[model samples]
Target: MHDLIPFIPGSVNDVLGSLPFFLPEIYLTALFILVLITNLLFGRNSEKLCRIIACAGILLVIQRDYQQIQLLFMSGRLNGQFLFNEMLLLNRTAINFKFIIDALAFVLLLYFGWDNRLKSHPKGLSDLYTIVIGSVLGLHLMAMAVNLLSIYLAIEMVSIASYLMVTYRSENAFGTEAGLKYVLFGAASSAMMLYGISLLYGFTGSLNLFSGNLLPGLIQANPVAVSFSLVLVLVGIGFKLSFVPIHFWVPDVYEGASTPVTAWLSTLPKIAGFALLINFLRPFVYFEKWDGFDFKLALSIIGIITMIAGNFAAIMQRNVKRMLAYSSIGHTGFALMAIVTYNSTGIAALTFYLAVYGLANIGALALATYFANALDADDMNSYKGLGLKYPAASVCFVIVLVSLTGLPISAGFTGKVLVFSSVYGIYQQNHNLWLLLLMITGALTTVVSLFYYIKIPLNLFLKRTEFVKNTLIKSQNIIVLSIIISVLIVLLGVWPDFLFKLF
Candidate 1:
């Protein structure tokens, strides 16, 4: 206690220094509170106003962060600086992730605003916006956190918001059930993570995961104990990642939640979660050999299993949302493969893949939602005979699905190429057979995905079913958004360098 007293204030100057770097998060929190007040005072009429406010707030933060990002990357200020006494990182990588998440939040806000189903309860829209904005703030925290305590806090913040958002449609039984499942699983994972943290702290007597003491302490400890604690800790990160073993919650939550909500769930948490994941493993870089408890090899194996499970499971899904749920699980595995590259090149690849994946995912889910609302259907069977009737929507769906399948002339293909190349590079440098097998599994799964991914287009164009009604549903907004996303996907495909250079 006496020794800890001296570390309390953390050099007054350091506290002040952290403020400047922390502006983006502070700005977001202030915006959240301001919007909440406005939401309450103005009632239903302020729903759209609050959305506008939220979008403007995120855009402002992005613009400010962009300037800082440029400065950090260009000026070489990222020489391992820590903020708030090593509680958070101040680096280009964290800034890049926050930018991506903020940008994604803006897109999601637009989605929530324009979605007719979400708009059913006017007052509820305000609550949803508030929750989403709060979640974005949590994402900012997740992006920069370096300490175990910070990591747990950020995860809880985002998880709580996600739990509520999944059940936003409280009137729907499926939505309620999904929310319950998420809450229960999240609680159990959080408890396990906290216990793991306590054990690690007891061993190391420090909270920082990447600090000097962590590895030394772990190395000195009993191997079985260290590995057990690490596995328990990883449970928290894996749930957010929705990879194999911890992935049981994804399909149900995705299928039960509204499409726009599902879109957010599929993309944002995974992005932030992976960022935290990389930092968590940085301490393990001290290993002198690949003989025992190799985090990289373990993750590679998990990635292989995840890709196989996700793709195979997707094939059996009749519901489009559930299929995409499984598809996302597959992509999660693919992203994990890129992760084990664990270097600058791998970071670039992972970042690019996530950006492209986020855009493509939102587009695909938007199209699905549009179809269900427009035709009163969510099954592949209902999509029969849709191509001729709704040419634009069906065509856009084809483009999104094609990108997702990693086909030619699309961003997803380039993303896959980048990830596989990174994985292969690791295999070459280290001669890790696990990575070799992972690369092969990734390739095979991509082929298998084609069968399921194409089912939508197949049902729309080839299979014939009785056309229920020729009447049109006004889904111009969804179709237009989907088309925009497809265009971006193709443009990125043709010039992968564009996004690659940015990251």
Candidate 2:
């Protein structure tokens, strides 16, 4: 019994040793608590205070993330350490993911209050800040999590935060309906994931993916059962990634939610989802002898199908948000191409691609807000002839769409090139059919994407409307942010190495 119990003092020492690596998460938790308390004490009066605190806290967290990178450099490149009794793994990849999440989150925190609809909520934006802080913490956890229990908890934390954000304006019936649908889909997926986790634990007698017992125990189990369990777990993650089949909730939710919340949904959670997926797949991909399932083949087919479905469906939509919603799903499929390679080059490309995609996606949506506020336009038809009146905003919108469409001299183009290069490199070595198919599908989808993306620019610059709105409502904040993002997209495109070196 004593041998089986092991030593308690050693575990305590291990936890104490892990604290330094966990400083970012600690600070995030502290920020979450501070924001919550501010919201409670001041209520509606705390909006500006909450935003200030949230943005400053994110900066602090980003600084800590940078420090973690320096520590990784000092320790030696690519080496990682498990923390909190092997519950989490800290590495260069995880740190990079956290940095991206925080960077985007900072933008989102500022944008939330800028939107007139969200700003006018009766309960105020203070609580929204608090919820975003909590979600950021979950995103950080998702990047580092190596334990099944930790993964599930991190995902649920983000999910619940998202549910609240989508329906922040409870006065809007559409928003309430979207929230209910999101909750329902999320609940079902989470339950499936929990059951899957339990099944995996039952088979392996452990919840840690990195533990010695997990792989060997899994290898000996019934292959059919193991595969079923893995698929169930993927369902939960798929919900966040919004891949086909599980992606049904995205169009409705994104359409109903405020523009800022739509930006948050399309970027932050999806970035974190990729990180989680990478962690989930690492063990199975790297294990020498385990061959119970073919992740490569499964992901490849899903990628091809997802890209086709998302892009084609996007063509039929005239509503700007719904179109972007489907476009995001298409982008999700394209990102999966990198994951299938499972190489260092592929991972680097993925990080860069996601960063660029997230920026452009956010910018595109911000422009939607700009048009909405200034012209009261929400669909493509209403955009006709407005380009001449709003030259700056219109040009910025064009640049963003170019980036999203992966056109030349934009970050999106560079990202696609890198993904193509990485996949081709893998194909050169193994000559795998799936790799070839992914590349082909990726290229075709890029072409298909052009049809819908071009619609906005055509309507803005080419199509003529008999009547144009001269009266405008000011939304300078959103317009400014969109212009900045457009510039970054162009800058990063010309100098891809700026991000490449970092990744």
Instruction: Summarize candidate 2's per-residue lDDT along 265-310 as a digit string, tens digits.
Output: 9999999999999999999998999889888888998898899999
For model 2, the superposed segments whose C-alpha errors exceed 4 Å read: 1-6, 75-78, 470-472
The lDDT of model 2 is 0.92
- For candidate 2, which ten residues in a row score worst on lDDT? 70-79
* Residue pairs with backbone atoms closer than 3 Å in model 2 (clashes): none
In model 1, the Cα lDDT at residue 218 comes to 77
Error of 2 at 227 (Å): 0.4
Task: Kindly list the per-residue Cα lDDT of model 1 for residues 1-503, writing each as its tens digit.
Answer: 99887866767779887786788888998999989998999987888889899999999999978877765657567654578878888677788788889988898898886666777763559889999999998988888888999999999999999998998875478878888998899999999999999898888888886666766777777888888888888999998999889999999999898889999999999999988887787767645532335788779888999999999999999999999999999999999988888888888899998988988999988888788778767889899988888899899999989989999999999999999888888788888888888888999999999999999999999988864665446678887788888899999999999879977
Best by lDDT: 2
The candidate 1 region of ten consecutive residues with least summed lDDT is 284-293
Model 1 scores a TM of 0.96
What stretches of model 1 exceed 4 Å from their correct place? 1-9, 73-76, 286-292, 470-472
Candidate closest to the true structure, highest TM-score: 2
